[model samples]
Target: MSAYDVARHFADSWGLVFLFGVFLFAVGRALRPSARDEYEHARTVVLRDEEPGK
Candidate 1:
């Protein structure tokens, strides 16, 4: 009926499932073997791109 009601419904029902699905997906993506190099590159690329100061 209202924004609060809609938000409450999502939070009580589908929101938990959606968050868990996202968590599982993130874990699966991180643990998948092919993602290793990509994540590693992600970790280092930021350092490589940064300069001496912020």
Candidate 2:
């Protein structure tokens, strides 16, 4: 096979897997119990009257 065809096949398979892996990692991190408090803080930080510099 030509170099371009080889590259395309590799990307079509490995690139998709890599992207899916990244997506799963992000979803897993976001849903973990340990992250709940941090997410809660971010969700409410705007409601508080804290300085923007902080």
Candidate 3:
């Protein structure tokens, strides 16, 4: 197969899998229970007069 054909095949298959895996990783990290406190802090920080992390 020519270079272009091989590259196209890889992109059509493994590239999709790689991107999906990355998507799952990001979703998992965001939804993990340990992160709840951090997310809640961010959600309410805008209403607080003091700066975050102070």
Q: Candidate 2, which ten residues in sequence have the lowest lDDT sum?
A: 45-54
How are the candidates ranked when ordered by lDDT, highest leading? 2, 3, 1
Candidate 2 accuracy as TM-score = 0.78
Candidate 1: tens digits of C-alpha lDDT, residues 1-54 = 999999999899998899999999999989999998998998887678566675
lDDT of 1: 0.91
C-alpha displacement of 15 in model 2, angstroms?
A: 0.9
Q: Runs in model 1 with CA error above 4 Å? A: 39-54
Each model's backbone clash number: 0, 0, 0
Question: Which has the better lDDT: candidate 2, or candidate 3?
Answer: 2
- List clashing residue pairs in candidate 1: none
**Residue-by-residue lDDT tens digits, candidate 3, 1-54:** 999999999999899999999999999999999999999998997888986678
- The sequence of per-residue lDDT tens digits that candidate 2 reaches over residues 1-54 is 999999999999899999999999999999999999999999998899978787
lDDT of model 1, residue 24: 100
Tell me the lDDT of model 1 at 7.
Answer: 94
lDDT on C-alpha atoms for all candidate structures = 0.91, 0.96, 0.95
TM-score of each: 0.60, 0.78, 0.70
